[model samples]
Target: MVALRGVTRTVRLPDDQELHILRGVDLTVNSGDHTAVVGRSGCGKSTLLNLLGLLDVPTGGELTFLGTPVQHLRDSARARLRGEAVGFVFQQFNLLPGRSALDNVMTPLLYAGGKQFWRRREIAMDILDRVGLAHRARTMPTMLSGGEQQRVAIARALVRRPRLILADEPTGALDVDTGQTVMALLDTVATESGAALITITHDVNVAALARACYRLETGVLSAAAIPTGANA
Candidate 1:
């Protein structure tokens, strides 16, 4: 559902020097595919995720989503596409401070019109149930535990039935056991929904859960071998 060829991202520093974030990165993510990207803290994984999520444009090369070229799309068009086809889960859980869990999940439907928007409450409730957060629907973010908040975030991301999920350090703030549970839930939900999942993480165990894995270094992405008996 996504493709990138020789993609590059560069930004001008305060001193007029150019900072290259991604260099000729090539990647393709098909429907129902699970891919993992592992990299150090400053190796440009976030830049790659922004490009894949349609939140930013590449400085050079090509990017397409479901066969349509996206590098030249206007900001509004790109936002529309992202709303319709992509879901995002982040380490920070990005939930609006005062919104209830159900309301948070329903936020995406405001962009999805007609039946989806009209039935957003019902749909959001169902997704909350799927993520085991039905009872917490009325709860505020501060009232919930870290794992519960993340679960709500996942529910919000999946409520739109998006074709692609971009997760960045989804389990970074959780304990080991909670992280495992969250990852398993993410995998299960993506598979059940037939959405491609691209996870950005620094954890090797997290990367092992994907069918394909790559490590980013020096602004480059290269495939990494999964050890024998790896989960993927």
Candidate 2:
């Protein structure tokens, strides 16, 4: 579970211009909850995710994960906590060009469990297998279709059994059909793992699959009630 209280992040441009990304945003995601955040482009969805993932500290207010006040943690402690608890998916996929699918999934585990390279590889392969990519485990990203590559990315995110999976526009790069497949894969993984999954999307159809949906407008987040089994 994750909670943000009056969280705000601002940046000052070189010319004394101030950009406020997140303005006192307060939200909570419960365990096993699939939540969708929909907003127009440049509305701070990804910035909120980065704050949730502990990749960046908030400029003001507080963020808590499982009741822990993470904003004040040391850099090393934050990194360790992030690796142990958070998984990430991005619009770009962010897969390594030289690594095979199996290798890419295993990358996270290397930082975990004492960094024994081969141990992570075995665990990664198992995750890849669970994602139905065992046969394509040896294939490179360039050789795989968009959906396949995204599945591999999902496998990589799940390799560590993270408690929270932050997906930022995960289906943005694929066509409609392919995007559906990718969303299905994400839903299946979160359900199987019982992890709190938060997906940031602009598409209403994609947002409907989530158990809860919220819309961001004018620096505020409001929950939206979507019909059951309508777009999932």
Candidate 3:
């Protein structure tokens, strides 16, 4: 559902020097595909994710989402498209401080229209239940454990029923066992929802769960083999 060809991102420094981030990166994500991108710090993974999520535009090359070229879209159009077709899960579990789990999940539907806005609570609750957070729907983020909070974050991302799900280091903040559980839950949900899952991680074990694995280095992305028995 998404394709990037010769994508490049560069930033201008105060000294008028240009710093290149992404260098002609090409990627393709198909419907219901599970893909993983592994990279180190300052390796341009964040820039790539921003471009893929439509939060930012590439300085060069073309990006297409769902068959529509997004390189020339206005900010408002990009925002609308992102809200309608993309779901994001962050490593920090970006939930509102005072909002309940259900309310947090309902935040995305606020941008969505029609029946979704009116029935947001029900939809959010259902997703929370799917993520095993039904009983914690009314709880605040502070009251929930790390795993529960991540589950709520997942629920929020899926509430919109996005066609593409972008998860950035989703298990980074949890313990090993908790992270495993969360990854399992994420994979199951994405498969069940038929959303293309793109996970940006630094862990090979995490990358192993994906059908396609890639490594990002020096602003370039290339396919990598999932090691034998590496699946968690």
Q: What lDDT score belongs to each candidate, Candidate 1 first?
A: 0.92, 0.86, 0.91
Compared with the true structure, the alpha-carbon lDDT of candidate 1 equals 0.92
**Candidate with maximal TM-score:** 3
For all predicted structures, in order, the TM-scores are 0.96, 0.93, 0.97
Better of 1 and 2 by lDDT: 1
Count clashing pairs, candidate 2. 0
Of models 1 and 3, which has the larger lDDT? 1
Q: What does candidate 1's lDDT look like per residue over 23-93, in tens digits?
A: 99999999999999999999999999999999999999999998988977899999999999999999999
* Candidate 1 root-mean-square deviation in Å: 1.7
Model 2 lDDT on a 0 to 1 scale: 0.86
| Candidate 1 weakest ten by summed lDDT | 223-232
lDDT of 3 by residue, 1-232 (tens): 9999999999999999999999999999998999999999989989999999999999999999999999878999999999999999999999999999989999999888899989988998999999998998889999999999999999999999999999999999998778878888998999998999999999776787889998999999999997443453
Off by over 4 Å in 1: 227-232
By TM-score: ranked, best first: 3, 1, 2
Candidate 2 residue lDDT tens string, 1-232: 7898999999999999988888898899887999998889888887887898999888988999878888789989899999999999888899999999988998887787564455887788788888889999889999999889889989988888999998989988888788888888889988889999999988776787888988887567888885343354
Q: Model 2 residue 166 lDDT?
A: 89
